[model samples]
Target: MTAQTTDTVLYRGEDYDLIGLIAAEPITPQDFGMTPAMISTACYRGYFCTYAIEDDRLFLVEMTLRERDGRYLPIGGIQPVADAREATCSYKDLRIPVDYTGSLRLASGFVRECYIHMGYQKASAFETVLDFSLDAGRIVRVHDRSAEAARKRGAFKKHFEENVAWGIQESFDLDMDIW
Candidate 1:
């Protein structure tokens, strides 16, 4: 939501125009799977800047990423249900990548999940836990218990169960390079 202007002038007895580049929206909703249920909020934002010249033009490009995390409740508005009908599991504080601010043609999305170990260096201590991409969605029934640890072996133990909401949670955008 910033302003940019171009100027035209005669330099060295030569006439020329300096046309500024077009500004594009940096975020959008579709980047995430779910739509805005009720007012959406941006959970996080990141930006990368570069100063470079190309084709005799000075350019300042920025890459930005935004996250939207919020969900709806069931009927009473206090609790959350997948839908008003209560068919699917209710989600809370869903996170989605915001693609509303950038060019619709160059948006990107992805998800990654990994485990986190709670206790290490001790035989009795619990270790290894599953960690999902928060920007991807919400999860439930995921926990790390000592008994579950005993059942599993290897460097990966500390077991936990989880589910995803598939709601819009996070996203990133980058400027296209000509070269």
Candidate 2:
């Protein structure tokens, strides 16, 4: 299995990979009346979204779609390009306010030793983990769970090293599984 591509989020002036589900009403290519072509096994979802948190509110900053010709097109938060060849030209960045009123998990500083070959890496594999609670796109609370995640990651690493005989560690769940 290929490692899946992750969505990104800009929070507190830093970029973090979004973990697990995105929002209560997750945006998709179909949302824009478009069908995306598979770019690669890693991006089977055919599209990826870039989100940002500004003024305590969440916004969908960008959306890139994979075309059948293997060309990635920025369909959202971009100015219309008269010429297809000028698509690479600079354009204004726009933000679409998202109506997500739920929890979001952001992670960064991935530990290479805890790398997984398939799917998204577990939250525990990251050196930093942040849990955010939002109300209608506005961040109501933030939890810095990095320390707790680090502890879990350390335990997983030790177990993986001791049980090297188990071969590749496909996935690690922080809340479930004994090790």
Give the top-scoring candidate (TM-score).
2
* CA lDDT of every candidate: 0.23, 0.65
Off by more than 4 A, model 2: 22-25, 67-92, 154-179
Candidate 1, after superposition: displacement of residue 45 in Å? 27
How large is the C-alpha RMSD of every model relative to the true structure? 22.7, 5.2
Query: How many residue pairs clash in all the candidates, one count each?
Result: 26, 0
Q: How close is every model to the real structure, measured as TM-score?
A: 0.14, 0.73
The stretch of ten residues in a row with the least summed lDDT in candidate 2 is 170-179
Clashing pairs in 2: none
Model 1 misplaced stretches (Cα beyond 4 Å): 1-136, 155-179
